[model samples]
Target chain A: MTETQGLHIAVVGATGAVGQQMISTLEQRNLPIKKIIFLSSARSAGTKLTFKGEEIEVQEAKPESFEGIDIALFSAGGSVSKELAPEAVKRGAIVVDNTSAFRMDENVPLVVPEVNEADLKQHNGIIANPNCSTIQMVVALEPIRETYGLSKIVVSTYQAVSGAGAAAINELKEQARDLLDDKEIEPKILPVKGDEKHYQIAFNVIPQIDKFQDNGYTFEEMKMINETKKIMHMNDLPVAATCVRLPVVTGHSESVYIEVEKEGVSAHQIKDLMKTAPGVVLEDEPKQQIYPTPASSVGKNDVFVGRIRKDLDEDRGFHLWVVSDNLLKGAAWNSVQIAESLLKLGLVTVK
Target chain B: MTETQGLHIAVVGATGAVGQQMISTLEQRNLPIKKIIFLSSARSAGTKLTFKGEEIEVQEAKPESFEGIDIALFSAGGSVSKELAPEAVKRGAIVVDNTSAFRMDENVPLVVPEVNEADLKQHNGIIANPNCSTIQMVVALEPIRETYGLSKIVVSTYQAVSGAGAAAINELKEQARDLLDDKEIEPKILPVKGDEKHYQIAFNVIPQIDKFQDNGYTFEEMKMINETKKIMHMNDLPVAATCVRLPVVTGHSESVYIEVEKEGVSAHQIKDLMKTAPGVVLEDEPKQQIYPTPASSVGKNDVFVGRIRKDLDEDRGFHLWVVSDNLLKGAAWNSVQIAESLLKLGLVTVK
Candidate 1:
């Protein structure tokens, strides 16, 4: 690709939920793409998607698919990313993997552009996107951490079914319809899709997001705990998360309690800092009843912050309500943003 | 009334959500009610409800209505309780008020039967029921607090719509139907119905519950904070809460993080303690996927506790998942239990 002709961009799992979002985000963003390749598994390979007002046919993903690709956005399962990300990297493509395959890898950089874009410089051809829940939270917390210096975080998430995948979203809708119609539903997806017992998500909350680990915390909770520290480069920061899946379809909301290093910092100072923070929108207005809700934050790229309050007793603690479109800022937009960061940082050059 | 005969019980606001539950709970319990009188506001009066196979007509609640009542349960709003509870007390009736009107009153004992039943002895003919969310949480925590001693509590609630009243429940269902039918809905009763703006609770989560106080905490949150401290009888216990309304119809779930005074207490020990704790049911089994969900906890009188886990960083900190039917254990059942406590304590004797 010539410098003026833009770069070759390939989207893996293009027919999937986050994959489709990646295509749309790429179309909407100012990413320079001369060629767009949509790749999916054999089952979804023949599907067609619209991007930039043009229909693009998805092809079966293969090692040769990345030969001429400058950047590959992967949203398939971890196994697919684990198998293909290395191949894409070897083929001269800088991959922004949106899976857990390499998120905690010592060699890979878990990038949330607003929080740790500088860490992208250490990426070894593959940049891992943080979990959707973690992405919105870190984006909202980064400014506070920078201004006040962070020490501890306790988060309880009200996550959407879309984060589980397109199938889980379908299950939520189907179960809801069945429940409304007074029919029985066999829940096959949610909390953990492949877990032994599937629980209904319609009008209910599941405390477990992913499978439980040996330590009793779900994998999703560990991801938030481990990824937040990794992305912020704070190895000793105390973080605890209770990851829960709600009946919502897209956006994720979190009630975060953070203890700052400074003792006298007020909630107003934190709100003021978040007002101009990168990719952050402040929507807190109690009397006017203005605050971020999942329905209101859908399709938005910015993380919405509201309900900021100082802890009633803890001098150093403050509470926040953070919301964002999980598919956008949490997944697709963050992946696309990482691609933009790669271009801005000159980590990837046009072939 | 004869000495062998049961006492006369009155249920104020009997046509409302919690009031209806109170009538049902009174019927289910072994409380000796020689006569059942259902009372509501003029708007809902004259409605007929069945109790123990007999239809009881709801009458307009007035000060004279409590003249023959030996025990009166009040769950109408705070204003109604403020107006009628004193009248009931003056009429020689023990008022088990389920509103916030007298909960913080110095003279009225705020009692969660399992947590602070002894405080009922200090009641000046009026006993206040703790907030629904606070009632369930305190029940689950009281056992642990008694065994391990609690120092601080941080809770995030996933509350049901019924806590707002029957109108909010109707709004949730209608909004769900409208959303499923691809129609627009005007939200009029959620996240504080009387507040300036309303939000869609169907397929969404609202961060605020009750009106925002001057100190920035929502009244529902402050209720949890203050009531927990008051019911637990720990004046200086640092408690914080973020109460949110979800689409669930009946059950309220809470994610509670607590620091115990004693160190090295495992989560298993806490779960063991809760197993035999009165009005507390332990449902934690990570390997078996056994945990208390709102849907499963609906219509149940017990506060279900699950997902008990020790904090990874703080040996003294533990996280618990507590769920209960907001109307049952949170309101009606707690009020009924207080009446039972009154009978058992010989505070209310047959005349």
Candidate 2:
């Protein structure tokens, strides 16, 4: 390929919540792209989106949409990814999927670039992006695991409504206004829209996030438990999660407790290590009341961590609070980061 | 005592949030109260309140306020209780303190009526009501501990702003309105009122709940830890907590993970036990989307437990989601229940 002719990239689901963030994040990144195309479902195909000050009309995503694409990013729900991602791969484009369709597949590599970039070398034409909650947690824990060797994880999430997508964000705002005016609120989307029931997410917290699995754990909880082991290459590690939805519109916060394998590590030592950890910003200052919050972490790509404390009884136990923009680091930014890794590692070349 | 006469009850901090709930809970109960008096700080003195269809004027609380009181319920600040509680006891009043003043005292018994009503029999004078967050969690866990010996507890709380008092609730309302209008908000009284800083609790969850202790745990976290062991009479029970404050107005929700001493106990057995547990409501139907949320648990006195699931890997580990109105089961309702227990146990007599 000539220097002037770079990669031909396509973004599916270009009009959705995380898809919009993908467009903007790609604009801010320095990826060498000769041509960029926007693709979506038949319903959202005709929408116009501005990328890097140029208006691009979205076309309907079909098998032919990936004809000349060198790299394709897919976020158009699990079913869409399940159908279209293989087509894109067959058409010679490396697929970076933002859904859970292929995350646990034996052939596909589940990747958080900070934790497992090398896994890309073994991907069978498709690389899987983890769930939003799992992505941010792995970013914070990877450093600790590398330094101290991790054994177990127990997490409780304070997730945002925007994780459900654009409609859930609108629902939170509308319901909050109605609640403030003392009007009756009718919730249409939240805590799983396709599920049998919908609950108010304005001033309330919902414990269920996705559909419940046969084992009584929500799919969101299982994703965190399974994907953490896959990304960290620790299949025997014990992981537990309680995923919940909060009223926030953008970022997700997690209260994580972990037991390290090595002993005699102090909380201050872990704090000092996190000060320079990749893709993580340490915002801990208890006396000054500085900590990571969902509102404070919106619109950024870094995972913010704070409140690092050692358990009073267990010598190897530590607690951490992690927050990140669910759309950015959890989805779009991570997908783009994987593409950048492909380019840097010479795994995929410009067309 | 004559059959027509009952016990004399005095309510301190009658104008505050929990104090008002205490008065209403008393009115709804059959506690055999001959006379009820409202007492508050000098600032709230002379405020008119209603009890049993009659108006009562709030009086300034002093040592003499408990002269003829048979039972005194204190929800005022810790300092007020510290100064006046012993005086009340000297005048033959059994005090149920809702503050953190005497909860850890060796001589004072911390009581959660559903879990440890018999502990009231050994109270010297003051019976300490545990923290609001702690009270609701213990109520849901005590039945499990009774059937299967308990060993460990790891909890992450989603607490309400009302736990910080009325000013914090107004702060949440005002900040939420300001955020919705796209206006800058000045946070004055959330996370911690007397702490050096205040955070916006409108659409955000704050990791810190109270003043930071030397061990890096917030005072709220320490209360949940220390009080759980004391109330359950298992001083060495390994209890770990991360208490976070959410935007809800009334209910406090918790994601609790526990490991019982017994093995091979299925999640179904625990659900069946919770169905008949005292002061508990089991709302754990995943198919119908029936579960306890902070919004649904508002104004209810019982601790709502749902999302009970056995650990996929650990045989003895299980998780539960517990919620209740922070003001009711957490503070006011628990205090009145303790007063009733005192009468039933013959620990105190009608004057």
> What TM-score against the true fold does each predicted structure earn?
0.98, 0.98
Q: DockQ (C-alpha) of model 2?
A: 0.76
For candidate 1, give the lDDT.
Answer: 0.91
| lDDT (Cα, tens digit) per residue for candidate 1, span B1-351 | 112589999999998889888988887788877887999999988899998988888999999999989999998998999898889889989999999998898888999888888898898988999899999999889888898899989999999999988889889888988898899999888887778888899999999899998888899999999988888889999999999999888899999999999989998898889889999888988988989999999989999999999998888989999999999999999999999999999988865
lDDT of 1 at A349: 74
Q: How far off is residue B297 in model 1, in Å? A: 0.4
DockQ winner: 1
| Candidate 1 off by > 4 Å | A1-4, B1-4
Per-residue lDDT tens digits of candidate 2, residues B16-54?
999999999998888988888999989989999998888
Q: Categorize the docking of model 1.
A: high
Q: List the residue pairs that clash in candidate 2.
A: none
Kindly report the fnat of each predicted structure, to 2 decimals.
0.69, 0.64
